[model samples]
Target: MSKVLQFACHFFAVCVSSNTPTAVYLGIMKHNGVPVDADLMKSRQQEAEQQMQRIRNEIIMLIGDVEIGANCGTKAFEDYLYQTLKLPVMKVTASNKEAADDASMIMLKEWCDANRPELSSLFTLVQECRKWSKIKSTYIDGYLKYLNSATGRIHPDFFALSTETGRMNCKTPKAQNLPRKSNDPIRVRNFIKAPEDHLILSLDFSQIELRVGAFYCRDRTMMETYKNGGDIHAATTSVIFSCTYEEAQDKHRKEYKEQRTIVKNVNFGTFYGLFPKGLQSTLKFKAGVEKSVDECEAIIRNLKSGYSALTTWQEETKRDAAGKMYIETWLGRRRYLSNIRSENWGLKSFAERCALNTPIQVTAADILKLAIVRILEGLPSRPWLKPILQIHDELTFIIPKEKLNEAVIFIRECMEQQPFPEFDLPLVAEASAGESFGNLEELEG
Candidate 1:
């Protein structure tokens, strides 16, 4: 116990100076609590339950008396998908069992669309049923369970040191996990509402990680894209598909639309030493775009060639990490990669990827924290401004309706400030305002 206490004291001494401001701000934010619309949440819960029941009945009619569990994760459902329906197993669990998870279902649905058109509806219904179930059980019921009866709000606990990359984590309702507008069919974000005359304002850093990656790699094409205010994704699309930048940016062309999406995903992952197989899986499962491994290889090859410095940086980073057994952000937050020198291919490969990812991601996280500290410093003069939530790359607050302009300007100034003296690229934070969390409109400059 004495030895453990000594180690803990040393750890605290090292981190306390850097983390104190964030800790203080998070404590105050938790105490403030997020205002909830109890009546609206309850109504949404009821509507979601009804939708779940309808979907459940439809699933039952499709698969007669299969005895699939509530989440469709039962052995019975596995048999129904693989043995009964004869759908090929696109993915498997860690134990090598046939997987019935959402990704698997999506892959199966795509297969059905191509080969067995009749079975596609079954997978569609299953996907809808699962989505509704998640909203009810995870978001609605989970949030209600923690709602404070006295305050009529939910107070989530935030941990600053929980993640390895120094990103914040929220729990006791997981406020940070709230779905975006595209994914939230039930408008779960609407549950968090501003008090009578107050409005919700959000400031999000635009493409921050990509910007950081360009700074680190010094990739001329990437740096030039941001420096000139060009669309990075569209620029990448041009490189990947061998088209003119205008053709890649053309909204009317279907091929450009699909290829641009693939390029966007690739750009986000490429800096992290994304491999061909991993790219293939990411495209298929996450983006729902089917790409063969060879095709994914070609896309990556083109990306590396276009952004020539990227491959150079990746190789140099991996070599340095392997030698030192650690990597660090620009702010000097170190993440040790013990497996960087491991003999096993998988372990060593994962460590190498972490070596590439930690610097870009952790630097971005540090910039956000710096903004939080600035907001905390400025909050005393503006007592009406209330900091509520910090999602990835975004900070949300509740402010007086009349103070919308004031709050937006102050918050944007704090967020757009240079995080460190060495960070050369201009940082941008887009602001939005609305009465509810779901319906925010971008505030033009």
Candidate 2:
């Protein structure tokens, strides 16, 4: 290729490959429109649509031979469906009235209910079909149809200030909202691949929210547990049940495992300011632990008593929000609490919880963004590396296979660098590498 043609091709390749915002690139280059590699984009779109159709057919087959009114359409069908799916009849009845045409994750999960273990495969198939169908239709097909016909690529517009938290939002293709890694047949991520001799390396923070929570509260037990590189959930379970980690895993292992799960839920929910009723429903449906509101209250009490500093911090944060009507992250990112002092109990409670949770979550978001910027800054120095995508806490890069070792170290170091030292806790990032985005394996440090 001629020098000018080669540079143009290289620039286009980088724009597509580096997760560069299309509008930003176009504006910088003074280009009126963006180009897409139509042939390549079309081939991938077709493959995804074909796979989605296959799954759709299988879903139909799995439902098998049920009469419309007998097993599908009528009230009798609803009853039979609940019985077969093992969903709580009352909940199904209620939600059916709520969203008779809906098939959301929460709804499907409710339908899966107590028989999760036995019906997990069925549930996976059902959900995968639904999720993949939407992705194929809304993203792949939509992107193909909407691609800049002249340029042959989709240039999704990204709005940095769209979210309540400081997270970037993408429209057109909604690139940020794509499905996560799943074991099911829907491999939408597979379409995202590295160029020849390059691999996609994903590095994600491990248990960042919990770590941030511990650091914020300065809860001695939590800090000690995290600092020692111990299992925080198991540690909390031990505290709640008065047993060692070993004992929790050894004697009555299954029961202790369930206990650990309860602790895990409490750990997550405490940050969200979940009430006993919320805990009770989550425990009953998600954890498969049938607990009454009173039992859930006891668990909440145990969590609070065990992590007194964290509980106190939560209450203090809420009080501060009620008074000042705002909360800020460690790095000075402010989330104004407009409804924190509302007279309506529900609105006030929601605002209070958001105030408590936003700081920790936004801190994590800030860290991730800083890490991305740092990674970008470091990339030019390493010629073989190009960052292709970032989803949530994970950053995906395209790097030569030979540079994997150095790349892993560099990425994790960038990711784990703490911008604010006073709020110190060891930040851990897990990594993986693969030629395709869908099949990354753990990169053990």
Clashing pairs in 2: 35-151, 35-153, 36-151, 36-152, 36-153
Candidate 2 positional error at 162, Å: 2.6
The worst-scoring run of ten residues by lDDT in candidate 1 lies at 9-18
Q: What is candidate 1's lDDT per residue for 285-322, written digit by digit as tens?
A: 77778889999999999998888899999999999999
Among these predicted structures, which one has the highest lDDT? Answer: 1
lDDT of 2 at 115: 47
Tens digits of per-residue lDDT, candidate 2, 176-288, equal 56664543244556655666787778898888888988988999999998888888887778767777877766646768667877888877777888799999878865676
Error of 2 at 101 (Å): 6.9
Off by over 4 Å in 2: 1-97, 101-129, 142-156, 180-183, 249-252, 283-290
